[model samples]
Target chain A: MTLLNAIDPWLAGPRSAELLFPTLALPVLGLLLAPLLGARWARLLALASLVVGLVLALACTAALVAADAPLVYALGGWAAPLGVELRLDGPAALMLLLTAVLLLLIGLHAAGEFSVRAAGRRATLAFWTLLLGVWAGLDGLFLGRDLFNLYVAIEVLTFSAVPMVCLKGHAAQFQAAFQYLLFALLGSALYLLGAGLMLGVHGTLDIAQIRVALDAVATHPPDIGGDARAATLAAVALMSTGLLAKTALMPLHLWLPPAHGGAPAPASAVLSALVVKGSFFLLFRLWLDLVPDLPQLHVGLLLGGLGVFAILLGNLMALMQARLKLLVAYSTLAQIGYLFLLFPLASGASGGPAATAALIQVVSHALAKASLFLLAGRILVAFGHDRLPALDGFGRAMPATLLVILMAGLALVGLPPSGGYLVKSLYASAAADLGAWWWPPALELGGLLSAAYLARILSIALSPAPASGTGTGAAAGGGHILRAPITGLAAPALLAVCALLLGLLPPALFSVMDVARPGMGSATAVAGVMLSALTPSGFWRSAGPVLTVALVVVLFHSAGESAWGRRIASIGRGVAGFEGWLRQWRTAGALLLLFLLIQVWTSIG
Target chain B: MNEAQLYGVCGAGLVGIGLYGAILGRSTLRRLLAFNLVGSGVFLIFGAIARRGGLAGGAQSDPVPQALVITGLVVAFAATALAVALLIRLATVAHEAASAAATPGSTDDPSTPATASQGRGERGPGHVGAGHS
Candidate 1:
C-alpha cells in the first residue's frame, strides 16, 4: 500500500487532492475544444475561456491577498527543482488577470472576425486557433518557472504570431511575415545561447537553482571561473539584446513596424498588446531573479541608455511614416521605449516596494498599447485604409469607432485623467525622487511624440474642412457590408474607457500594483506636483509643454542642415559593420558550436 | 565513431550542408528546404545530447530539452505549413502575371488572366489542404 501510494499519487479514488487555483485549466479548456469547434464556435468559446481565466486569475489575486506572498502551485504535487511550478505571485497574477481581462475585451472588440469567412473558413480557423495558442503560450510564459520551458513557450508564441501576418496571403503581407520569421529566429537563437550558457555553469535549468548557482559563483568562484564569468556576462548581453530586438528597441526593430502593420486588426491587437510583453516579462524575470547581484549602477545605466535610444529612435521613425497603420506601429515602437525607461526611472536608491510606481507604469503601458492598436485596427477597417491623409473623414463616417480611438489616443498621449498620463506622472515622480532628471525630459518627450503622431489622426478627426469623404456611406453595398460588426469595434473602445477609468481610481490600481511589489519599498510618497498645477491653464497650457518638446524633436530629426538621418548615415554603416559579426565565418560557426557545447555540457555535467 | 557521437556528427554535417545550400541556392523553395534541413540537424543534435542522459549518470537526459524539441518540432511544422501556403499562392500569382506579360497588348483583356489561372486552379485536385499542406 505504501509503495503503491508513492507511485500513483494523483490516482486516488476520492481525489482528495486539493484543486489548484486552476489557472492552467482555463486555457486548457479552450485548447480541448479549439480543434473541434469551427471558428464561429471558437469566438464564444474563447470568450468563455477568458471569462473562466479571469475568475481563476482573480481567485489567485485573492489568494495572494490572503497569503500576503507568492502562491506556488506544483503540478501533481511536484515541487520546484523537480516539478514545474506556477507561482501566482502578485505581479505574475496581476499580469495574468490583466491579460485575461484585456484578451476578453479585445476578443469582444474583434467579434464577427471569425465569422467573416472572407479569406475562407480556413483563415478563420487559423485565426481562432492561433489566438488561443497565443493566449495559452503567453499565459504559459508568465507562469512557467523553468527557463527551458519558458523558451519553448516563447517559441510557440512566435510561430503562432508569424502566420497571422499573412492570414490573407497578400504579397506585401508575405514579405512582412518572412521578415518577421527571420528576425524572430535570430532572436530565439540568441536567447537560447544565453540560456544554455547559464545552464552550462549551473547544471540545472531551474530559475531558483540558477539564481543560487549564480549567487554561489559570485561568492565562491567555483562556476565563476575566469572564462565562465565572461561567458555569463556574454549570456546576459545576448539574452537582453535578443529581448530588445523582440521588444522592437530602436535599431534592432526593423521587423516590427511592417509585421504589425500587415496583420489583421484583431491579430494586430494581440500582437502589439500581449506578445511583446511576454519578452519583457522575461527581462523582468532575469533582472530580478538570475542577476540580482549584477552591479546595479552599470545595469541601471545600460538599461537607461537603451530606453533613451528607443525613445529618440522610435519617435523619429514614427515621424517619417506616411501610412496610418505604420505610423501607429512606429508609435508602438516609441511606447515600448518608454517601457524600457521604467527600469531606470523606477530602480536605484529608491529600489524598494516604493518602486511600485514603475511596475504600475508597466501595467498602464500594456493596457494603453493594447487599446491603441485596437483603435488603429478599427479605424483601418472603417475607412478601408490606414493612410494618414485617408483618416480625414473617418470621424464622421465612424463616429463611435472614432470616439473610442480618440479616447485611446488620449490615454496614449498621457492626457489628463487617463491611465497613461497618471502612470507617467507616477513614473516621473519616482524618477525625480531618484534624482534622475533627464528621464523626466525623456518621459515628457515620449508623451509629446505620442501626441504628435496621434494628432495625425486627431487632426484629421477634428479637421474643419471635409476630406472629400469620397466613399459611399456605410451602407452603399449591403447591411452587413455597410456597418462594421459592432462587437469588434465597441469591445476595444470599452477597453479604452477602462484604461481611462483606472486613472480616476489610482488608489485601487496602486493596490493591485502593491500585490506585485517584489522589490523593497523606499516608503516615499511617489506622487508629483499636480500635473494640472504644472501648467498655467488646464488643457491648452499642458499642450504647450508637449508642443515645445515636439518642436525640438522636429528640429532634431528634420532634413537639410539639421538632418539627423543624413548625419547618421555616415556612422550608422560603421556601427552596422562592427555589430554584423554574425556574417563572419569563424565567429558565427564558433558561436553556434559554443552554444551547442554548452547545452551538451550542462546535460552531462 | 560510437552511436551517440555518430549521430551528433551527422547532425552537425547536416546543419553545415544545409547552411551551404541556403547560401548558394538562388531558388526560394530550395532555400526553404535547406532551412528545414538545418532544423532537422538541430533536432538530431538534441537527440544526440539526450542519449547520455539515459539511466547512466545523465538520468534520462533532462525531460525539459526533450519536451523543448517536441514543441519545437510542432512549431517548425506550422511555420513550414504557412511557408508552403505562401509558396503556392505566390506561384499562382506569379504564373498569372507572367502569362499576362507574355501576351502583350492584352492589358485590357480581363479573361486573359483568369484563363491562365483556370488551367492550374481548375486541375487543383489532390492538392494539399491549407493547414496540412
Candidate 2:
C-alpha cells in the first residue's frame, strides 16, 4: 500500500460521511445538550435525536434493500483491525431500525408523560442521554468488526441501563438496581479478562482478521496436548457466562425482576423493551465474529433448552403473581427465553430447518415483547396499582387499554393471528426438522403455560368491575388523572394491532428480513406457519380442566425459590418485618454494623 | 507500585468487595454505595485493559474504551445522582407517610421536608453535599 493509501482511512468518501454523520449525531447531540439545558428540554432534545435517528435508520434500511451487501465505513480512511470500521449490513440495519423506532416512540411517549420535578428534570435528562447511549452502544455493537471496539459498546450499554433501574427513587429499587449493577460489573470484569487473554494470544483484535487467524490456530495439530484450545474455550465460557448474567438468562436472572419490575413505568418500558437486548446483541456479535465458522450447534441447543426452562418457569411465575409489575417482569423472562431460540435457529445450516425457523421466531418475539412491556406500562399508568386482583373491573371502564393488553397478551401467549404465533410456529417447525420433535412439544407446553397466565390477566381484565369499584383507579376519581396512561395505551395498542397484521403478512416480513444472508437454510422451513395459525381455541371453553392443569403445572414449579418465588417471599418478609426490622436494626444495630462492614470492605479492597 | 499495576489489583479487589457488599448489605444507601464501588472498580479494569491495548505492537490506548469510559462515567454519575435523589425522596415519603398516618395532616410540618432536602439550598447543593456528612 502507498503512503497516501495509509494517510487517510478512505479516499475523501461521501459514503463514509453518510454512515458516520447520521449514526454519530445522536450521541454528540446528547453530550452537547445534556449539561447545558435543564432536563425538561433535554428530553425533547432526546426525542428529536431519535426522530432524526428513526428517519436515518429507515433511510439506511431502504438503502440496504436497494443495494445489496453490507455498507462498510472505515474511520479516518484506515482499514482492518488497526483502523476502526463501521459496518452496516442488512440484519444490523434492521436491528437499528427496530431500535430507533421503538426508542423514538418510547421517548415521544415518555417526554410528554413522565413528569418528575427536581430529580424528574435530571432523570428526564439522564433518560434521554442513556437512551441515546444505549442506541449508540447497540448500533455500534452490531456494526463493530473488532473485539476491543465491541467491548466498549458493551460497557456503554451496561452503564446506560443502570440508571433506568433506580430512576424511580423507591428505596427498594436502590437494592434492586445495585444488584443489577453489581452483576453487570462482574460480567464486564469477566468479559475483559477473556478479551485480555484473546488479545495476548492473538495479536489483532479485529474479528475478521481473527477469523482469518483462527484457520492456522485450528489447523495446527493439537498444541500442548490441546491446552491452547483449552485456554480459548475457557475464555469463551467465561465470556458467555458473563453475557448470560446481563441477559438474565436463567438462574442469574435474580436482578431482572427488581430492575425491570421496580422501575417506574417508562423506565420499566425501556429496561424491558431494549436494554436486555443490548447484551443479547453483544452475544450475537460474539457468535458471528469470535466463534468458529462451524461452531458446536449443541451450545446454542443448550441455550435453547435453558430458554425452554425459562419459558416454563417464567410463565408459571407470571401465573402466580398478584402484583401486576412482577407478572410483567416474569413475562419478560419468558419472552427473553424466546430470543435465546435464535442462537439454535440461526445456526440454520447445521440444522437447516430449525435455524431458518429460529430467524422468524427472533423477529416476532422482539416486536411482541416490546409491545407487551409498553402495554403493561400503560395498564399500570391507567390503574394506580398494577396488582392483578386490583384490576378486577378495569376492562369495562378502560376498554381501549384493556383491548391493547389483551392483544399484547395474546401475542405473548403465541396465539394465532399474531406475530408471536408465527414466530412460535417457525421455532416449532424448526425443532421438528431437527427430529428434535421433543422441543416442539416443549415449546407447545410453554405456549400453553403462557396462554394460561395471559388468560389469568385477560380474565381479570374482562371481568365486570365490582359494585365497590374501589380497587381499580375508577374509585380514585379516574378520568383526567391518568391522561399519560391514555397516551401510553396508544403506541402499544398500535404495536399489538401490527403484531396481528404482521402475522397475516409473513411474506412481507420475510422480504425485509431478507437483509440477513441466508447462512444455510431453505425458505420452506416456515411450513408450520399454517399448523400454528389453525390451532383451535376449542380447548378454551373447557377452561376448568385446562385451568386446573395450568395450576398443577404452575404449583409444581413454584415449590422452591424459583427466582420469582424467592422474590415473592422476600417481598413478604420485607413487609411483615418492616417495622420489626427497622426497630431491631436501630436497637440491636447489627444490620447497620453489617452495612458498615460492607462499606469498609468495598473501600479498602 | 505504578498506577497500572496498582489499579489492576485495586480493581479486582474492589470488584470482589463490592459484590460482597451488594449481596450482604441491608442498608439501601450502603447498597447504592457498593454499586458505585463496583462501578469504580469496573472503570479501573477498563483502564487496565486500555493500558494493555496501548502497549500492543503499534497501538495507542484504544480511544474507543476511553470514549466508552467517558460515557460510562457520565452514566454512573447520573445513576448516583438518581440514587441520591431517590434516597431523598424516599426519606420524604417515609416521613410524610409516617407523619400522615401517625400525626395526620402534619405535612405542614417543615421538619418533614427538612430531613429530605438539605436545610440550606441557599448555601447551595455543593454546600449541602458537604453538610450531609
Candidate 3:
C-alpha cells in the first residue's frame, strides 16, 4: 500500500472518494456539452450545472459537518505520492458554494445580456462554455491537494478568464487580455519552478506529504541538511511571489483594473468576484496549511504592509475614476488588500478568526462587487455610457438599481448589518488579540476611504440634472429605453441583500469554517463577538465614521470650483498618474522581481 | 560537479535569461517567447531533479519528475498557443483600427468610433503605438 493509504484508509474508501467528483465533473460536463448544443441549450445546460453544483456543494458541507473531517479522494484509487488527490474541507466547500451561487446569479444575468438574439449565437455559446471552464477551474483549485495540480487549475482559470475579458472583441479589451495573459504566464511559470524545487527536496508533490517533510526538517534540521532548508525557503518565496502576481496584491495589481473593467458586466462580475479569489485561496492554502510555521514576523508584516498599501492606494485610485466600472474594479483592488491582512493576523494565536474574517470578506466582497458590476452594466445600458460625471440624476432613472448599489456600497464600507462590518470587526479583534496596534486603525481608515469613494459615485448619481433636462433619466439618454429584465435587476439586488444579511447568518454557519482547522476558534466565539458588537452604540461607533466621511466626501466633491476641491482633485490626478506609471510593464516587472528578492531574503535570513 | 547539478545550473541560467526577456521585451510576441523560455527552464530543472534521483540511489531516474515535466510542457504549450492566438487577433484588430483611422468617412463601422476613443483612454501614451511597434 502507498504511504497515504496506510495512513488513512478512509481517503481511499468509496464514501469520501465519491464526494468531490460531482462538484468538478458537473462543470466539466457542462463545458463539454456547451460546445455541442445550440446557444440557448448551452446556456440552459450551464445554468443547470451551476444549480446542481450549488446543491452538491451544500451537500458536501453537510457531509463534512456530519463527518467532522476533511474529505479526501485519491484519483483512480492511487493515493498520494503516486497519484493526484482532491480534498474538500470546510473552506473548499464554502468556496465551491460561493462560486456556485455567484455564477448562477451571474449566469442568469448573462442569459439576459448575451441572449442569442442580442449577442449572436456564437458569442452566447462561447460565453457559456468559457463560464463553465472558469467554474471547473475554480472547483479544481479549491479541491486540489497537489501543488502541481493546483498550478494546472490556476492556468485553466487564467486561460478561461483571459478570453472572457475581451469577449466583446474590442481593441482596448484585447490589449488588456494580452497584458493579463503575460502576467499570469509569468506567475504560473514561477509557481511551477517552485513546485519542482519543492518536489526535488521533499520527494513528493502532495501538499500533505510536503508538510510532513517540512515538519520533520524543522525538528531535525541536520538530518535533512541545511541545503534542504534553503531549497524549501526558496521554493516558498518563489511560490508566494508568483501567487502574489496572480492575486494582484498592490504593486503586482497593474493588470487587474483594465482586464476587469474592460469585460462585459457579467464577465466582470465573474472576474472580480471569483477569478482572482481562486489564486488568493491557493496562496492561503500554501501559507496557512503547507508552511504555517515558516512565516516569521517580518514576512507576515511585509505582506500586511502591502495589504495596507493596496487598501489606501486602491481606494484613492478608485475615487479618481471617471468610469463606474473602472471605479468598481479599483475598489476590488482595495478589497483584495483586506484579504492579505489574514497573513499577519494569522501569525498570532489561532489562525481561525483571521481566516474566517478573510473568508467572510471574500464572500461579502464577492457578492457586493458582483452586484455593483451588474448595476454598472445596467447603468451603461440605460445611459449608453457609464461615465460618472454624466450619470447625474441616475437615482431618479432607476431607483431600484440605485438602492441596490447603495446597499452594496454600504456592505463595502463596513457599515452595520453588513458582512463588511463583521469582517472589519473580526479583523479588529484579531489584530487586537495579536497586539498589532496599526492594523485596526488601517482597517478603520480603509472603511472610511471605501465610504468616500462610494459617496463619490452616489453624490454624482444623486445630483440634480441640468436645466436642459438632457440627463433627467434613462429616457433622456438619446431615446434608448431601459428594458432591463426583472431577472437582470433582481440578480444584483439579491446579491446586495445577501451581502447585507451575511452578518446575520446563524452562529452554527460561522463555525463551519472551523472544521478541519479546529485551531481557527469556534463559530460561536466569532458570532458572539458580532452579537455583542451589534448594539446601538456599537452600530454608531462603526457606522458613524463611515457616514460622516461619506458626507464630507460628497460635499467636497460637489464644491469642485473651490480651492480645496481643486487641491484634492490635483492630488487625485497625481495619484492616478503614479498609478499609471506603476501599471507599466517594465515598472511592474521590476517591482515583482524586487518583491521576490525581498521575500527570499526575508525567508533565508 | 555532477551532471545533474550542471543541468540544474544551466536551467537556472535559462530562467534568468527568460525573466530578463519577459520583463524588458517591448513586443508581446517576444514576451511570450520569454515566458516559454522560463517554462522550458523549469522543465529542465525538473528533469535534472529526476536524474538526481539516481545519485540518491532511488530509481535510475525518478518517474514522477519526468511525469511532472511532461505535464508542465503540455500546459506551457497550451498557454503559448493561446497567447499566439490572442496576439494574432490583436494584430488584426489594430490593423483594422489603423486603416479605419487613416480613411475618413469610414464611420459606417459601428466599432470604429468606440475603439478609437477607448484605445486612447485605456492605454498609456507609450503603448499607443503598441501592436505596430
Candidate 4:
C-alpha cells in the first residue's frame, strides 16, 4: 500500500466518496439536462445544483474535521499510478465551499439578468449551461489531486469562461473572448508541458506521490550530473509561468480587463470571483505542498515582485479608467496582486497569519467584487451607460444600490469592520515576522491607491441630483429605474453584507482554514492562536495606518484637484499608454517569455 | 540524443514557433491557428514522455499520458471551433455595422429620423453596452 493509504486508510474508503458526485458529476448533468428542459427550468436546476453542492461541500468539511485527516478517494477504485485520485483536504474543502456559495449568489443574480423573454431563449440557456459548466470545472479543480486532472479542469474552465465573455454576441465581446481563449490556451499548453516533464521524471502523476518523490530527490541528490534538478526547475518555472498567465498576474494580465469588462455582469462575477482562483489554487498546491523546498526564497521573492508590480500598475490603470466596469475589472487585477503576496509571507510551512490572511482576502474580494459588478449592472440599467462622468447623482437615484456599493467599497479599501481590514492586519504581522519591512508600507499604500479610485466614483455618484428625480429615472429605453424590484437589490445587498460581516465572523469560522494547518484541530485553540497573532500592535501597525491613509485619500479627493493632484493625475495618465501597449498580444507574449526565462534562470541557478 | 530527447526538442521547437506566430499574428484566425500549433506541440511532448515508459506497469509506453493527450486534443478541438465561430460572427457583425453606418437612410424606410437618432443613441458606435469594453 502507498504511504498515504497506510497512514489514513479510512480516507481511501467509500465513506465520504459520494461527495464527489455533486461536485464533479452534477454540473455536467445539469448542463446536459439544460437542453431538454425549458430555459427557466434549466436555471432553477442550476441554482438547485449549487444548493446541493453547498450542502455536500459542508458535509465533506464536517467529515474531514471529524476524521482529522484528509479524505482521499481513488477514482474507479484504482489507486494512484493506475488511476486518478481525488483529495479533499482543508484548503480544498474551503475552496469548494467558497465556489459553491459564490456560484449560488451569481446564479440567483443571473436568473433575473438573463431572462428567457428578455435575453432570448438561446442566450438564457447558454448562460445557465456555462454557469453550471464553470461550477463543475471549479469543483473538480479544487478536489483534483492529479496533475493531469487539474489540467483538464483548467481546460473545462477556460472553455466555459470564454463563451460567457461573449454571451452578448457583440463584436467587441467576440474579440475579447477570442483573445482570452488564445491566452488561456497558451497557459494550459505550458502547464501541460511541465506536467509531462514531471511524469517523465517520476512514474506517477499524483500530487502526494510526486511530493514524496521530489522530497526524496531533494534529500538524496542523484548523480545524474544535475540534469534531473535542472529539469525539475524548468518544470516549476514553466508550470508557474503558465498558471500566472492564466491568473492574469501583471505583465501577463493583458486579456483580463477586456474580457472581464466585456462579459455580462453575472459572467464577469463568476470569471473574476472564481475562475481566476482556479489557477491560483493549483499554484497554491504547487508552492505549499509539491515543491515547498526547491529554490524557496528566490521563487517566492520573484512572485512577490510580480505581485508588487500588479498592485501599482493595476491600481494606477483603474484610477485612469473612464468607465465603471473597466475600473472594477482593473481593481480585480490589483486584488489578485494581494493574493500573490502570500508567496513571500507564507513561504515557510509554519502556517501562521499570512496564509489565513490571504484566504480571508480571497473570500472577501470574491464577495465584494461580485457585489460591485452586480451594482454596476444596476447602474448600467439605470443610466444606459456606466461612464464615471455621466454617473453624477446616481447614488441619489438608486439609494439602495449606492448603499450596498458603498459597503462593497469599504471592503475594497480594507477598512475596519470589513474582512479587508482583517486581511491587512494578518498580512502585516506575517510580514513583520519575516522581516519584510517594505511589504507593510506597500500594502498600506495599495489600500490608499484603491481608495482613490473608489472615492472618485463615489463622489460622482453622490453629486447633486437634477431638478426632478423622475426625469433621470427613465433610462433611454424607457426602462424605469424606480421600478427596480426588491429581489433585484437583494442579491448585491446580501453579498455586500457578507463581505462586510466577514471580519466579524467568529474566529472559529476560520476552522475551515485549519484544514491547511494540519495537526491544529481544536477550534478554540485556533481562535486563541489567531487572537494572539492579532495583537493590538499588529492591528494598529497595519489596519490603523491603512484606514487613516484611505480616509485622507477620500478627503483629499473630496477637496477637489490641487496642483499636486494634477501632477499625480498627469503621471497616471502618462502610464496609460504603457498600459495600452501591454494589452497588445505581442508585448504580452514577449513578457511571458521574459518572465519564464527569469524564473527558470533563478530556480536553476 | 535518445529518441525521447529528440522528440522533446522538436516539441519545444514547435511550441516556440507557435508562440511566436500567435503573438505576432494580428488577425484572429492566425492567432487561433497558432494556438492549435501550440497544442500539437504540447501533445507531442506528452507523447515523448509516454514513450519514455513513465508508468508503473512496465508497459511499452504509458497509457496515462496518452489518455491525457486525448482529452487535451478534444478540449483543443472545442476551443478551435469556438474561436472560429466567434471570428466569423465578429466579421459578420462588423460588416453589418459598417454597412449600417455607411448608408443609414437606405437600410430603414419606415422609421422617422427621430426614431433613428434614438436608436443610434441607445446602441451607438463606441458606446459599449452595460460597460462592456
lDDT of each: 0.61, 0.61, 0.83, 0.76
- Minimum summed lDDT over a 10-residue window in model 2 chain B is located at B115-124
lDDT of 1 by residue, A1-605 (tens): 89757533322322212223356666755766876987667767877888888876766666566566555667878886667777655567667877888788777766565554554677877887787778787888878878777877787788778887777665556656654664565456556546655654555667777767656666766553545555565566656655765666554565676678768777877888788878887877766656554324255555666667677666655654656666667677777776666565545322443245445555666676677677666665555556554344456566777677767777777766666666566666667667777777777777777766665565555443332434432322222224566666666666778766555553443554355454443122323323352355755655677666545644443323545666665464444343233322223334444443443343223
Which candidate comes out best when scored by TM-score?
3
Q: Summarize candidate 2's per-residue lDDT along A481-519 as a digit string, tens digits.
A: 354446666677666676655556645445454444555
TM-score of chain B of each: 0.69, 0.69, 0.79, 0.74
- What DockQ does candidate 3 score? 0.43
- In model 3, how large is the Cα lDDT of residue B100? 92
Q: Candidate 2's chain A scores what TM-score?
A: 0.81
Best by DockQ: 3
Clashing pairs in 2: A9-A76, A9-A77, A9-A78, A10-A77, A345-A355, A393-A465
Candidate 4 off by > 4 Å:
A1-14, A222-225, A466-482, A519-566, B54-59, B105-133
**Model 3 TM-score on chain A:** 0.95
Note the DockQ of each predicted structure.
0.11, 0.11, 0.43, 0.27
Q: Residue A376 of candidate 3: its Cα lDDT?
A: 90
Residue lDDT tens for model 4, A1-605: 68756534333344766566556777878878987887877788888888998877777877677665677777788888777778887778888888889998888887877888779888998999899889878888988988888888888888899999888876667767777887888888889889888888786778888877766777665665367667777887899899999999987887888788868888888999889988988888887777646325477788888888888888888887777888899999998998888888873553457767777788899999999988887777666667675566777677788889888978887766577877777777778777888887777778888877877777676766444545533232234443567687888899889897776677777777676455433244335434643567745654565556556766776677799889987776568767766766777889988889998888777
| Candidate numbers sorted by DockQ from highest down | 3, 4, 2, 1
* TM-score for each predicted model, relative to the true structure: 0.76, 0.75, 0.94, 0.89
TM-score of chain A of 4: 0.91
Task: Score candidate 2 by TM-score against the native.
Answer: 0.75
lDDT of residue A391 for candidate 3: 74
Error of 3 at B133 (Å): 8.8
Off by over 4 Å in 2: A1-17, A115-120, A293-298, A344-362, A468-488, A506-605, B1-133
Q: Write the per-residue lDDT of candidate 3 for residues A1-605, one digit (tens) a residue.
A: 68756534333344754768887889988888898887878888998888889888877777777678888877789889888788888788889889999999999888867879889987888899999999999999999989989998999899999999888887778878888889988988889999999988888888888888777777775745567877887898899899999989988886888888888889999999999999999888887888746336367777889999999999888887778888899899999999999988884323657888898888999999999999999988877677777777777777788889999999998887788988888888878787888898888898899998888877887777665755434332435546566567888999999998887777788777777886776476567667866899988898888889988988887776887877877776677777777787888889999998888887777
